[model samples]
Target: MRPPLAAVLGIDVGLLQSGMGGVAGAELACAVSNAGAAGCAGGYKLVGAPLSAMLDRLGTGTDRPVGINLIPEVVGAEELDHQLTQVLDETPPHVYVSLFGMPDDKVFDRVADAGRHLVVQVGTVEDGVRAAGLGAVVVAQGIEAGGHLLGTARRDELVAALRAELPDACIAASGGIGSPEEAARAVAAGADGVLLGTAFVVAHESRAHERFKALVTAAGESDTVITDVYEIGWPGRRHRVLATAVTADPDQPKKFIGKTVVEGKPYLVPRFSAAVPTEATTGRIEEMALYCGLSCSAIPAETSAADVVAGFAGVLPGSPAVTN
Candidate 1:
């Protein structure tokens, strides 16, 4: 039998790929889903045509379950509604919606009304209970998570707490989980599954820039630090990233450091921007926000997304072999 979380997600494995902005695009998402694990594409600040195009590609890429991640803190309510609307219209029923933070009742109701599955990543047990009550699967995010800091709790501890509070809920653990051993440890700690970001960041199908993948693969235990320096685009939020010269000094002059093309639209990346380096980004890549977790220490090289998922199948309880 599949694990509770995996069954809830309609996947063969309990492992989930994080919807990392600029990294987890359609190719990566399809690769993971084809491997029998749940996959997600980052829906960061995308609206209208770009969002619709991506959704269309994801809908056609794989028949397995997939999700689109949206951060409520990054986009306004009106924009989020628009994004959600387009997502519902453009994708099939199998494409679920995932939220990084706790969304308001209206947002939860919207997804529920559409009879679609909702996954909400939360930093606290209270939020997990609330999300479960709202009929959504809950992802317990720990402090070790890369990109954005959801809470200060440790991964195992948070998962344990959520389990204690809601025994029947489909709870997954996120943060600092890079290897098969770590995934097993999370399950031992009461998580129904594990969600990994750093491990997939180096996947060949990931859209992360080559330089970013190189840095993550070469990173050590102490290479990452949590800070708010790279918060121009999404300010006041702390995130864990590889220590760069820009992070070393927060007062550096704000300037355009790079350029990136998203959904065929080019945009200049300013210094301290929250934008991650992708294949479409160029110029001073190392100085930008290089989101990484302690899990980077385990990701030794770039590999296919299918291989990444296969690595964890053995460790995840009830996880089946990858069909691909």
Candidate 2:
């Protein structure tokens, strides 16, 4: 049997409450960490003065291992690139990354100067090996994920493949890792740890809107769809969001999926095709669409982060089965 993943992350926070691009806020980041899960912060849309406010808020909360997911796709764009460069230059987190390979050498070097550990997300083993060689920890995210898939390769296959190469670097698995059992599976598959975005997005403490939470709660294993519509971040990258008018667009094939942002790193644009027809229906089902993973099936309704963490904690990789 594979050993239970020992906690060497130094994260006083649970390490399970990862933050999200759209949902992660100062309150959620600190609270989850205070609750014993590693607190994480997402800064995809944040730039300029907003960066200060975000960090200030995070400081108000617990001081656990905080992460700032810097998807190069957003900041690397021609329009926002400069501002992104400056904002990221000032970030104070212990961990940082150039999402979808954005920020490039300039940003990576800066993070190192600040004495921070950099984690790079990759979709291919080639990228993994290269990143490891560059001295950045690698996160092998699969395609079955919610927000963005940084890989151009197959997620499942890449997970096992990357393990063989970057043995010394810390490897965390993302993409469709929504449950404790799924986490255990990844550890069993040899991942040093797992980073779950969508799973925590639906938690009660999550800053995601109530409507967004409902969609995740009502969803089943087979309910979500992966598509390229409403994406302006990463060009060919796709994500699993609630099957709404956006993904349901019949014109998806004819028209390039509408990308909202320029960097187009992992997700392009993210406007849901469905929305409450009226303010009354804001929380209604038909109007709300959210990003989730294939692991959406295992989540319970409106649960607490601690309970959720406990549930997932039990799903640790079991001992390898004995052969006859």
For each candidate in turn, the TM-score is 0.97, 0.77
**Residue 141 accuracy (lDDT) in model 1:** 92
lDDT of 2 by residue, 1-324 (tens): 322222434543223344566566666666666654455666766666666667666665656655565566655555345544544565545433334443456656665676666667777788778776766656777877776556655455677888777566666677777666677677667676666777777777676667677778888857887776635444555666778765676453333222322122232322443211111222234423467877778766777666655555444322122111
Positional deviation of residue 53's Cα in model 2 after best superposition, in angstroms: 0.9
Tens-digit lDDT track of model 1 for 239-283: 999999998988999999899999999999999999999999999
Question: What is residue 132's positional error in candidate 2, in angstroms?
Answer: 2.0
Cα lDDT, model 1, residue 321: 50
Badly placed stretches (over 4 Å) of model 2 are: 1-8, 12-18, 77-102, 152-154, 232-236, 250-289, 314-324
lDDT of 1 at 265: 98
Location of the lowest summed lDDT over 10 successive residues in candidate 2? 274-283
